[model samples]
Target: MSDRDEQAYAGTAEGKGPVRIDEELARHLENKREELFEEFEIRDEFPPEVLREAEERAADPEGDIRTELEDRRDLRELTTWTTDPADAQDFDDAVSIERTDTGYRLWVHIADVTHYVAPETAMWEEAMERGNTVYLPAYTVHMLPPILAETVCSLVPNEDRLAHTVEMHIDGETLSHESIDIYKSVVHSDARQTYNDCEDRLEDPDAPLHEANSLAYELAEKLHEQRKDDGSLVLNPKRDRAHTIIEECMLKANKAVTHTLQWDRGLEAMFRVHPQPTPQEWDEALQEIQELDGVSIPGDAWDDPRKAVNATLEEAPGRQLDKIQWAVMKVMPRAKYMADPFGGHHALNFEIYGHFTSPIRRLSDLVNHWIVYTDGVPDGIGDLCDHASDKQKDGETCERIYKDFLQEVGLDPHAVNNRGIEVVDDPADAEYTA
Candidate 1:
């Protein structure tokens, strides 16, 4: 935390706001982060040139959007809105959906980051080097400069911003894609909603975007059931309705884009692949789960390890849930990025899958946008896949170490994540100080 961060939570209420710490413990936390960043080779600061370029691009956002307005689809009439965490800084994706005679018409609009950060731009190169956003409790290392991402690239309400939209007509009966279209568009979001707001809207008839939120969950719930039926492993089946809506929609869009690249267009792009566990490894995980004090898996679900884990997680005792999850994770293989989609993703049980909805924080999505726009493949794509996979691992590791250090200093990572951090002069005001 910096001097600005230290003062961000100066007068937070004792129990209602951030976790307060004294100056001495705050220094220790800062020192540990520096050591960890140095050890892991993580870049925390953006180059001056990249920041300058970002500033220049963001200077006249509306004027730039006007220039491209004639070339792109104008979708300002569509009822579009974004949902994110309450503390989110940038809104990357927005969704619009409606019922059709056959099924549903869904539109997922993602930020046109390629419009601002092209291959030759400094922001693009800096984003490539960082690979993805690194998020720690109460802190974040952004892939792109915050000013640019939170400004022009953000799909804020009532502003016409450039976007890469995925329009899909889904068959409600079979839960299959009827058609898919990818294109650039100018979108106007009606409102920005929080997760809690979505939940409230689900229950309130008069709330804003109520019908849209309800219809999204109606489709999302079906998608969720279909995914599980297709042998997809859902570790968090009990997630809240708001999260389910976002996750299912993103998955559907990513899958739709990946299928278009592989089956429809026959182009080589970044694909997400996951390998399955061996039979013996599955047996070992199941045996471990069954041996737990208050956990059991049904005989029918054992035929599919993914299904088996889901069943157990839904029924297992609360106290034994962590053990059950760890057992399954111990045997599961890590998913990685690849150009070839031959192996498939076992966890999602999808023939093809790739990221497309989060260009602001992910390099793969940013590159894929360029590939889709130009209809051309970049050189050394395999090398780029490897770099993305490795850098993602590094970010996850860095986060884990930072969280562990938080525990060492007697701070609850979850609390700090939710309420943020504050520094106080008085020791009595500190939540934890050692």
Candidate 2:
């Protein structure tokens, strides 16, 4: 049975999984499951065999079912996948490396999203409304249908998929490149290597996969080190959970997107930029830390602003930096959707940083890829940006309302009263504006 069929069965009564008390309870317990059924309204229940198969599929690390669903024949044809399975489908971008007299020419082929999602179509409308996919702990609700997001728009490897290729040449160390070309082309990904795996290989050249593909690994490290030496702060904190291969893969993809836009295409990219704390805010936070008399700055106060703040937090051992960072975020202009061709990313200290990869999870990246591919910005790029921002606000409002409702249901009086207030006891805010 297909993976979808198996998933359907696992959620049914006959599956080895514990039977639900009733439909209502089941729906209540499994919010996502209920939402899927209610939204799509799929009535047919899966067979017992299908449920077992789904269980097995879920345990599989590669997410084969999702890939299969994405690479269905009809979808493949629609998205222009004309390559063998092993060499095709699933990669959303490809990078070509070639040795040049001076350095190397890098060709980054991103999936052509505009080819599949035309404006005013249901898919496009839904995607725009969503702003982007919302990832929960259990499952993902895609902005577009599986066919469009997974198969057609995905720049899967080995497949002759349509792409907006960005070709450029890099000098010795710096990421200095010009936009060589931005046009539709058929291309394939040579390989799919995650960041952690790549890092491991870099640390140990004798690693299993390192022997086969050492050049890419070496280049990535060189690039990483170069960026760090040039004032790019490596402040990526370890996530709470152990790093999985899948998470590493996603990070590598994200990093590749940023590098391609900065190094391959001389395009100014919108980054998740964070500015240093202003003196006033910093002083206030510092005073608070000083009040904790025995406490000191956590670590070394390095030259880098990011590291300096992190070090201070480590020394002081308080939530001052967190509070200051949050306030500083408020003071700074929020990074929004934009098309910048000059290439300026102050946060990373790079000239460019754009989100071009992960079309499957982010609508902005999808639209950004389209803009890069077409060589000119999309007709309604500005409107899309505004709409996406508004939609994000709406989602946040909805989550807040839901949380408030939950608090009410759970009889949390304090939460109910402080539902919207950020600061309740600030005497100076007697005449504060909302």
Candidate 3:
């Protein structure tokens, strides 16, 4: 650890506040990890039986993959592709868009993890216990074994994979919705495009994929405007056009799956719910913003906090915007998983919201897929909802701890006081009066 980091941990910084740092940073992180697992009741490792089953499946990949394909529409010929970080390990979702006479036909394909790991099986039990994968800066602890997480269930390029499809038709005018269909399907990704590559494609007029890239961005702009009109909170500032396009596609798919599950009243599943801020929470947030920049929040902000919060964020100075955003988020309650979709996502302004994408990493999405296929949720889903929420919090704790450790070791210079050290030229001559 650097001297600054040691001082920060040891509570020796000049007169800010008292903090207890009795142990080394790495040792503290180890203890914190153990505490988190204990507090959240997380199972850190897969069961022996699960490992055995996964090993068997990995040995004969072809035999099991053939049996897992059923009731799947063959979409391998479509112009389908995935967009993620360049170093992304597990590719869980992909998109395909085509122009229609009245609107656009968009298909969101998510990995069908349930096809291989059925309910009540050892692998399923392990996944349920883990709740979701915890990603640290240097590594990831997956919920499933490598057989499914990295190879079988991952939607790799040029490989045929099974998936659950959310097929919807978007109106060309308002970019509003139309009919929605959910089903199991098979697809072969045309390419594994990165966000950087997508941005390049958007700018290249002569590129072969220019049309599709432009169409996706255009739809994303409309969706963004629609959300702003509905008073959705804009916590994150507008990023790259490519990032927005991928986000909008995933948001649409999640919303569609949520609505379908709600329509099928017989199904019992968890929903990604976010409650409106209480009066006290809003007051605290306003007070924080006032202290930071002496900006007064409008009185009408009480009725629609999303608009008021977003407006203030826009007006914040660029130098202090990150701090302002962090303060505002700290005052709001965290979103959680619930058994019902009564309270939708306040940040997104959606009437129904659930996680249906990234099933390979999250267990809730896998459960939703099961509901879509079997029309039933597993028993004790409510308890599972609470467990999943706690596990997510624990995962965040793990990441924070690892990040601190990395900073201590100088692996992440940004996390420490990185101002360059002053160097004296001809130090000996200067001291001895050259």
Question: Best candidate per TM-score, number?
Answer: 1
Q: Candidates' lDDT values, in order? A: 0.85, 0.44, 0.73
- Rank ordering of all candidates by TM-score, starting from the highest: 1, 3, 2
The residue-by-residue lDDT of candidate 1 on 56-133, one tens digit each, is 988998898899898999998999999776556677899999999999999999999988898877888898888987
Query: What's the lDDT for residue 23 in model 3?
Result: 34
What TM-score would each prediction reach against the true structure?
0.94, 0.55, 0.83
Which residue runs does candidate 1 get wrong by more than 4 Å? Answer: 1-15
Candidate structures ordered by lDDT, highest first: 1, 3, 2
lDDT of 2 by residue, 308-361 (tens): 444444454344545544533444444445544243444456454456554655
Candidate scoring better on TM-score of 1 and 3: 1
Count of backbone collisions in candidate 3: 0
Model 3: ten consecutive residues of lowest lDDT: 1-10
Looking at candidate 2, what is the lDDT of residue 229? 55
